[model samples]
Target chain A: MRLIFMIAVLAAGLLYTFYAFNTLNFLSASGRLGPGFFPQILGLGIVSMTLISVITEARRMRATTNYFAAPADAFPGSALLIICMSVLYLIGLRLFGAIPGSIVFLLAMFWMISRGKPILNTVIAVMAPVLIYLLFRQLLSASMPEGLIPLPF
Target chain B: MEIFSDLMMGMSVALHPANLLYLLVGAFVGMTIGVIPGFGPAAGIALLLPVTFGMDPVGAVMMLSAIYYGAMYGGSITAILINTPGDAGSVASTLDGFPLAQQGRAGPALVMQAVASFTGGTVGVILITLLAPLFSQVARNFGPPEYFLLAIMGMLTLIVMIGGNWRLGVISALIGFALGTVGVDLESGRSRYTFGSAELIGGINFIPVAIGLFGLGELFFAFYSGSHKKRDGEMLTYDGKSNFWPNARDFIETRFTLVRGSIIGFVVGVIPGAGAAIAALIAYSVERSVSPRPENFGKGEMAGLVAPEAANNAASSGAMIPLLTLGIPGSASTAILLAAFLMWGLRPGPLLMEQNPEFAWGLIASMYLGNMALLLISIFAIPVFVLILKVPYRILAPLVVVVCTLGTFSVNSSYMEMYIMLGAGVIGFFMRLYGFSPAAVVLALVLGPLAEESLRQTLTISRGSFGIFITRPASLSIIVVTIALLVLLPLIQLYGQRVRKPKAS
Candidate 1:
């Protein structure tokens, strides 16, 4: 898994390096380094480092079964659920209004993470967003997105 | 005379009702996070960065700084009673603190930690009050080459001295430098990597990236790592039987030790990359060496408890001097504060004292008030902190997610920034899994652009001659240090290994 993760990073670095080399202009007509110089340098560095990381990871994998001392299963289903919930919450915040969207998002999250206490989860789900709304919108006067439902602060 | 008058003006600002309230709140939040065993001061301050958007810069800094030292005070509570160091800095505390707890003297251990922390923090502030002006005076003479070299030296120190895989640290910093390039170029007036998006012209906002990386990334980690899962530990219940306050004899015995640790911590704090954890460890070793009862150092010795606790708090304050005087962060917490300074359009340096003396001196003044606030809170607020620990991660996690998402959005009301935050959070999660230092990346993100700008400006001034850096004495010295750290030290180590190999053969 660690090797695969490194491989992916190496691939990304290579692609970014290729794109930067092709598209970005490193030197201007005036003969000085342009805006692209630093990015190209960074891209090249990333490629070299990621390549080194891949080789190092492969050598360690060959030396031992438990190379990185990582957990047997670091990513469980709850983690996946949380990730999905985060994406869904982001989408909801854009589609619905900030307050209404957050209320639903909070309730769903509270329901999932709570210890099967519906009443407590529900109360928290309702109160948490309202308090946050009051803090950000009313107190801080932040300009939140007004989508389907306009929140009256 | 000018410094005194400026400090008085700062005192008035810090004493304002609004700023005072925030200081109390920040201290409470800091303590809460400290006792919880996972949420350290870095995340606590990062979590609250957005909320400070509405606040004045002085108040914002005052509140955030209160959280930093307050967390130090709170971490000792758990270290002494529960026998678990709240953060790495408090690991030394557990050496003697837990043993004292086992001996049923937990109350006295806690009292000593608070007093030691107060003493150290007070001394650190005093040192800062004295030393910051001298440092600022020196900093005023620095040019672009010096600034460039300073940034390089700062990055090198962070990458090498953080006691991790240096390779990963470099990669993390490179990644940050890459991200920093995503915005429009300041000098060339050209877009580097915006990919033709209009919103990209304004660049990636620091607040969302910060909130996502530290706040959401931490929550994501907790879910996967099970760090927030309840562990079995004996919680010491206070019965109001033991003396809560340290006796005069206790202070008299530990006074020199406290002073020594404070000075060590303050000096260490001013240097980049060495933070409270290193200070605490070094202070513990120094105290053990100097003590007559060296063998009793970790055996519930009073000096053991006082040394590291004082050192960590002192180091926390000491870390601020560089951040305030030079616009360079010495540690992760200071990096977040620097981000706040940038967000407020307030650059910290010698000119900050000249142009915005109220904001500059106000922060220093608030440190005094914050230390006093932490002393009072640490004595009277342990139960409150303990109660906060009872709020299960199940509830806490969701609330954090809401806060982070909302905070990210509130920065610019741009859904694109929120999405960028989400992406940064994911990247941060993987970076942590891969042993990359998120703090290194953050420091790079905050300093990389400034460093790049300075480098370019120096080049322009030198008419593209690379010799400009070496021509300047200050820049040359800093460049020499960077080379030693990045190159010479490694070669020497490799040579040592080769000589040892031949001996073994």
Candidate 2:
């Protein structure tokens, strides 16, 4: 079943490459290398590798291997939590810059991680990223992206 | 003698006080992260890159070198104690060390592993000093087409060597390759599969995806499986009685294994697609083939313990071949190293060796001394590392997740990457629980962009004919090897199974 799924995906990739190459123009009468020239060649390679993948999948379909096993149920509620944190991080970094954004991400992450930890532990984990960022940006002068609300670099 | 002279020159630069201190710090941090389950040298290197971005090129490389070899030293510790190899590179060590642990010989097993790693590092460093310039000269002969074929070969390598079911490996490689296609096509600047997201114009980074798939995925599965409802075992406690040094007999037997393993490792490392994991596997198999008492392997044999360690450390040295000589990276870790190099405005390739011999040679020298420092530090650090294992997974697991999240977020300061990590983490966890090698995914991600770009360049040069792959001698031969690997790997596996069937009956 998964093989079929993969074949479908491979087919789509090849078809897309074919279509993309057909629609794209060379955009030049002549040059050392035309833009379309590279795309077409890449499309061909993709098509070839995809073909190899299809043949290999078919061969494996005939082969014997155990497929089923117990599925895992670990880390419920983690993805959503991750998504929320990431959104806040995206919004926060611009406002606070590297130091504050990192502090927020780290402390919140520590809270998520520490489970029942005391305030001190949260503060420590939070401080780790912030301190590292300060050391890099201020002391070492490593440049970083300043998001929405820029703090002093 | 030339090797010694070059090495002496290398030491002159490596031993500078500032350089030496970085090496020490790199080794220490490398060991700490390496010994931890689900974190290894690559992640350690990735995390350190942005932090070290401002350092001088030599100092930056000094720390990375320490981490590289130090991780090699630390990998076998968990393999012995917890029956879990911290990284794939150390998996072979577990076959012997874990069994020795079962037999209450963990100390000897660990000591043996550490000694083997040191020897391997010594051999590997020698090869780097002697072989890099020579091999690099050969690598310069490669054109864009050849490098493209090399990446293709890397994909096929994962196809066979992936530890789990072959089907999943193919799927994992496919998905990884496809994901790599998401960003702007280098030749056209046209996005392939980004679905019109401006954020993905640069493509999906393997760093975040790799961290998610390996670190986050593993963490989720550890808790989700619920297999370990009860933790009732004395595996960690009693092993204190075993001697923590390889016996004279072990030394006598394993000396050749270390040498052979390191040599094989360097050769594999030189291969464009093959990396440390493949080298280690090949080393383990070579030792098995050459062992007088073959049945002793995988049953607490010192040869098993030493072969993989030597191979992995040597392969780390091997990876430097491309970086120093050809400018292409053969593995995921090296890819980051490349980025770090570029960050420092130091272009690494053919010109690098010619323009900055001291810098290049100095980096090589650090590994020789760094590996020695790793050996000494690890000996005294084992008792402490074993204690870290005592931390309950309940807390440690979440902490891992958080660190990976923060690490991902901090790298680009893009929360979009953080979300990508979570989604990729889920896919990766399933990939892992299903037996797909995370390294394969990482490899795909690392090489996918380069492969895509090169294939297009070669085609453009060839005027859109498929014959371009073979018309060029170098590209043609590399493709042949990839095909040969794909075909021969299955046959070899079948033979191994057939041979094992008789014994089972």
Fnat, model by model in order, equals 0.68, 0.17
Off by over 4 Å in 2: A1-153, B1-6, B163-206, B225-242, B434-438, B465-472, B487-505
RMSD of each: 4.5, 5.1
The C-alpha lDDT values of all candidates are 0.78, 0.69
Clashes of each: 0, 5
Runs with alpha carbons beyond 4 Å of true place in candidate 1: A66-75, A148-153, B83-86, B231-250, B480-505
Candidate 2 colliding pairs: A73-B224, A74-B224, A94-A147, A94-A148, A94-A149
The residue-by-residue lDDT of candidate 2 on B307-359, one tens digit each, is: 88888888888878777776667666776677667656777776676687778
Clashes counted in candidate 2 amount to 5
Specify the highest-TM-score model's number: 1
